[model samples]
Target chain A: MPRPNLAPPDAAPLREALRGIRFLLRRGGATVADTLTLDALPDPAAGLAKRMIREVEGLARSVDEAASAAAKGVLGGHDNPAEKLDEIVGHSSAAAEFGRAIYTALDAVLRRIGVDDAFISEMSARAVFAAWRQDHPHGQPQDWAADLTLRLLAARVIRGAVPAGSGSIGRVEPVAVFAVLLWLQSDRSESENEAVLEAAADIALARATEIAATIGSGDQGRIAALYRKYVDHV
Target chain B: MSKVRLTPDGLPPTNEPLRVAVRRLRWFKAAFLKHAEEMGAELGSRFEVDDTKLAAAFTRWLDAIELQRPADKSQRRAFFEFAAALMMRELTVDMPLKAVGEPSRAQTGSAAAFWPEGYCCTLFCLSVHAAATAQEFHADTTIDPAIDDLRHWWSFKENTIRDASFSAGFLQMLLGSQPNWVMPDVFRAKPRG
Candidate 1:
């Protein structure tokens, strides 16, 4: 007879197992709240427990920033914010180009809404811009590039409208709409800008507010074509 | 079947993990077939998963081995096939690698004629290892292994997305598990009384 090769489930890394251990010590009469305190663990495990607690506390700050970004209409609107940004921006042909396009589209959409340069500059000096500045120092900030790409994409998606009864938290509409329209006339499909035109109309209808601009027949394809770039970038 | 609307709201939630959930998709079967076929080119008596039908492939394979009631065989096998497909590239049989710990009482029944514990152990390890290693955070290469990473991530997301669909406390209940878990039925220990 052969022995069945059995094994126990591998323990998570010492660091990880240390991360999940919660000992309820009734000796001190402490509640679940203090289960993570160093006093709860024996001296052997105290150092590691304290380190784990600090690391967890650090997340509160990140979450705060992400929520702030989301309220300000940046890229924190998903469960996996950092990863989601990566997944979306990874589709871009180039970082500089995608970053440039998003900025342009955001500007155009804002102008279409009749906001001035001061507001636009004010917006740029905020969170996403801060991230870009920090990351862009050495070379291409691909992640921040993705973040910029995401903000405008959300704007575009929101402007196009979420499902009925679903709504976005911010106006975060458009700024570089003209920039988004760039290269639309560059030898792509004639109806390439149809999405932009349709989305613009949809935005108008959903808001029941008039757009400051009029659509031209010749510009329709061009606008739609540029939006296809949004699809590609997203 | 008619076209199924795939809105975010429409995706039905399930208790099964990715390894099990993927098998139900026709695309996964197609993908796994590619993995198995590519593996078949030079293999000899490998632990080949009988991918005849996506539904009962795991059950049939397990029945041949354990003769136990087929409760969650597909889910168990799906995990195996997933790991096998991933490990078949570089993972070989009978390396000096020894799995630690003894078999639980659940796995001790078939110790003789057809002991399938080794295969299950390898599959479980590979799948679990892949999962633990592949986590993503703010940093790409660097991993700050702590329960806080998930808390911060979840807190930020919940605040932003405001997913109203699930019942209250659903997210907390799910996230509260220290090492988030799945109910893979392969070599499952008996329920606590």
Candidate 2:
């Protein structure tokens, strides 16, 4: 795979992202599932789902901020005009709506947990990917992480492990994940990063397996316990 | 050709595509199971759904299709496309789509024509962006462009782009571009022998 032609003007943000990722790497356990007990997962899961909704809203705002900051930097908004213009336009309406679907699923999970929010705002995006990578001891061959997440979510829904509303997202089987991974692996520009993603996908699968096992035991009575344990602070 | 729509567990015509889908999905299941076996990952006996079971799943859907039961058009399409793409994707795994160029249907302003590009471009953009995001950790690595290479576009008919690799790339790119995006590391492709 080829690399991105250009680099972000400031490495600070990227560096900060790395530090946050490291922190997540050292932390063990599926934090989301840990936050709620089995019986209470629906409610809290719904809350976390809602948090994703809010997260998307917040993200839109952040994109605006990043645009503004980039505009103010060296170019005074004149740097790669075409690209800058693209950024200014920001995320599309369709994309925002898709975010809603993702949030809806999260919301369903929250409902089962019996809460309105999990408040994992401090959780960095990089960290999530890192933890995913750590989860895979074997090399990840393709984009299996997303597939694993999708599979677990879908299976949970199908089995009635998650709230009823959660089933709408549907099943994202391993084949789907593999196809995308195969596509990415095909790109010359990104060939180097293939191993990294493969690792992430592998870990994602392993983690999903763990989560499924936990849930398979029929509501480990853990989600509710976590809710009572942490809801007060939030 | 009469458009015979299918239900989840409908009977499928012993035709090219449906048979292909079942055969390919079975292969996928086997491959995944093999991976599980190698890792000693415990594809638990209970969790294990063998080729026989998977074939049963496909057969059930094919049977439903033949019965003319109400079926999910979207899901049926998804199942068909998944099988198609997996076959093509695997066939050309090591080959760059750019090296191959656009497929015939893509040349005639067909929907599938843009699929290769749409899929490859979106995936390329996301992969590069994601890799760039992770550049600090793993230095001196090139990402895969097969997902975005334009060559694969030539393989499909005009109406297949949506079913092409485009949707996958678009979704992942959307995920990557989000402000509060929780980047899934799976977007990164691992090196294979």
Q: Which window of ten consecutive residues has the lowest lDDT sum in model 1 chain B?
A: B1-10
RMSD of each: 28.7, 24.4
TM-score of 2: 0.19
How close is every model to the real structure, measured as TM-score?
0.17, 0.19
Q: Per model, how much of the real contact set is kept?
A: 0.00, 0.00
TM-score of chain B of each: 0.24, 0.20
* For model 1 chain A, the run of ten residues with the poorest summed lDDT: A19-28
Error of 1 at A29 (Å): 69
lDDT of 1 by residue, B67-117 (tens): 323367555432332232222211222221222333333223331112222
The 10-residue segment of model 2 chain A with minimum total lDDT is A77-86
Q: Which stretches of candidate 2 lie over 4 Å from their true place?
A: A1-125, A131-137, A140-211, A214-234, B1-18, B23-193
In terms of docking quality, model 2 is: incorrect
lDDT of 1 at B42: 18
